[model samples]
Structures are given as C-alpha cells and as structure tokens.
Target: MHIRRICESEGDAAGTLWDHMCRETGDGRPLTERARRDVSRMLAASAWHRDAFCLVAVHPGGRLAGFVNGRISTGDGLLPGLLGEIEALYVVPGDRGQGAGRALARAATDWLVAQGARTVRYLSCAGAHDDHRFWRSLGFEADMVCLSLYREP
Candidate 1:
C-alpha cells in the first residue's frame, strides 16, 4: 500500500470513496443522497478543500483503501489559538489491520503539525471498541465525552 496526500485533481475519486466509507459505516442510516452530493460539491468547492488536508492510502492496483481528512484552525475568541482536528478516517473492510489507517493518521497529523497546529483531536463514538486502542496507540488520550441530543428532521 502507498500513502500520500490527495490533490485537487483527485477530488472526485476522493469524494466517491468517502461516500462509500460513510455508507458502510453508518449501516442503513447513512447520509441522504442530497447530502452525499453536497459532500462531493464541498470537495470541489476549492475553498473548503484548500482549508483541509486529505491523506489517502492506495492499494497496488491504485484503489484507495483508506483516507484521513483534517484541518487546522484558530479559535474565533479574542485570543485565538490553533487547533488541529481530524474530521474523518476510514479504512475499507479488506484493508483493515494492514496499517493503512495508521499511516493515514500519521500523515494527517504530520501535515497538521506542518501547518502550525499545536494539538490534534478526533472523535470516536461512545462505548469501547478496538478503535479506541488504535487511537491510543497513536498517542491520543480520552479527554472528554460529549453527548449530543438530536431531533429527527
């Protein structure tokens, strides 16, 4: 497998792969078709795409097996401080346990640090799972638990 940053020219492929990963992980409750289209649009919007860095792990046949997207932003407060956040990380089922996820995460974090970020963060769903250990192995510690109350739209 090969790991590298994704370029603007690869936006369509990246968006399609991201949509597939989201669908698989969300079971039957994945984003709506409109939302998926919106995601693709966002990927092509240039502004948002430029604000974040995307890392893709490719297979020998050139298929993307995993990816991570992150951004570094400063708070809007009076005294703004930089924060690095990983918005998504997904490894296709066939690529799990092959270190693709780790490589993508490492690349994403390193890119964030290069962009002048001081701290990195990612969100994992509630309840324990092997993924928790994966993040821990990457030197991430559980800092706080957040609860979200949502209403059906």
Candidate 2:
C-alpha cells in the first residue's frame, strides 16, 4: 500500500469513508445536516485551502483503503499550548491490520510536525472498540477523556 496526500478532488471518497466511520462509531446514529455540512467543509478544505492536512492510503490496484485528517490548532485553554488535532482516521474493513492506518497516521503526524506542532491529539469514544492499539503503538496515550451527556430520546 502507498500513502499520499489527499486532494480536493478526492472529497467524495473521503467523505464517504468519513460518514461511514462516524456512523459506525456514533452508536449507529445518522449524522444531522449540520454535522454533515461541517464535515463537508472539512473535506473540501485541505492544507492547500485551509489549515488542515489529509492523507489517504492506496491499495496496490489504486483503491483507497484509508484516510487520516488533522489540523494544526492551539489546544483548548485548559491544555494551554499549540497542538495538532486529528479529526478522523478510517480504514476500510478489508484493509484492517495491514498497516494502512498506521501509514496514514504517520503521514498526518509528519505533516502536523512540519506545521510546527510538537504534539498531536485526537478524541475517541470512551466505550468503543477500536484499533487504539495502533494509536498506542504510535506513542499516543490516554492523556484525558471527554465526557458527553446526550438527551435520552
């Protein structure tokens, strides 16, 4: 597999994987229009168009296997520093455990570092089963947890 920077023309593919990953990880709930719009903005804006970076992994036959998107940003006031925030990382089922995720994350991390970020961080669902082992292997640790309380419908 080969990893490459994502271009604006790849929005559909990236957005498709992103929406799927979000739904898969969001307790099976579909995203609202507002959320979809936000994601659309993110997908359309890359390092060339915005302060963000996105990388995609390509399979041998040129299929897109995974993608990682992140942005350079100052941390929340509480954290008190500049850092890169990884917004999404998704690997198609068939590509799991094959290093595509790692390659994409590494590329994103490298891009963030190039943009002057000394640290990179992302949020994950507290109770979700995921390839966090992959993150841990890349030197990421659970520095903190975000809490959310949603209305019961």
Candidate 3:
C-alpha cells in the first residue's frame, strides 16, 4: 500500500471512514447529524491548518485502505515545548495488520518531528487492549490516563 496526504476530492471517503470509526468505538448506532457535520468541518479545516494534516493509505488498485490525522501544537500550560498528536487513526477491517496504519502513523509523526515537535501522543480508548498494543509496538508508552463520569439529564 502507498501512503500520502489526502486530496480535496477524497473528503467524502474520509468522512465515511470517520463515521465507521465512530460507530466501531461505540459512539452512535449511526452518527448524529450534528456529529457528522462536526467531522466534516474538522476535515475541511485540516487543509487550511499548517500545523495539521490528514494522510491516507491507498491500495495498489487505488482504493483507500486507511487514514490518520495528526497535528502539532503548544503543550497545555503544564508541559513545555511543541507536542504532536495523532488525532485519529483507522484502517479498514480487511486492511488491519498489513502495515497501512503503521505507515500512516510514521509519516504523520515524521512530519510533526520535522516541524519541531518534542513529543508525540495518541489517545486510545481505556480498555482497548489491541489498540494499546499496536501503539506500543510503535514505541509509544502510556504517560497519562483520563477519567470521565457521565450524568443523565
């Protein structure tokens, strides 16, 4: 598979993949209309953000197999230096384990390092053992944990 930045014409494909990812992660049966719109806005804004980018892994036959979105920014007040974040990463079920995810991640992290990032981070669902392993294989170590509580209306 070949990896490269996503093109303007491929927005819908990327959005579809994003929706799939959301569902797989248990976000919604089908993403709410507002959620879909939010994702579209984020993807559209990526092209204009110099510090952010979205990359796609394409099959030899020209089908998109996966995508990763990354960005570089100043760390929150407690931390120093620039930070690189892997905002979203997903590989089509059939394409997992074939290195598309790795290639996309490597490219995004490399770009962030080139832009002077001092650290790279990705947030996986707390209980996602497989996802955790995939990132660990890439040299990422857990440095933080986030706890959340939900309240019914």
Per-prediction RMSD in angstroms?
Answer: 2.8, 2.7, 1.8
Winner by lDDT: 3
**What does the lDDT read for residue 48 in candidate 3?**
62
| Cα-lDDT of candidate 2 | 0.78
**Model 3, position 72: C-alpha lDDT score:** 90
lDDT of 2 by residue, 1-153 (tens): 899877777776777777778777646766676776667567767737557877889877877898998888876655545688898899998888787888888898888888878778977776654666668889998888677789999
Task: For candidate 1, report its TM-score.
Answer: 0.82
Q: What's the TM-score of each model vs. the native?
A: 0.82, 0.82, 0.89
**Looking at model 2, how many pairs of residues clash?**
0
Against the reference, the lDDT scores of all candidates come to: 0.76, 0.78, 0.84
Q: Over 4 Å off in model 1, which ranges?
A: 26-30, 44-50, 76-80, 151-153
- Record all residue pairs in model 1 with backbone atoms less than 3 Å apart, i.e. clashing: none
lDDT of 1 by residue, 40-102 (tens): 565545334646777888888888787788777884533346778898888888889878889
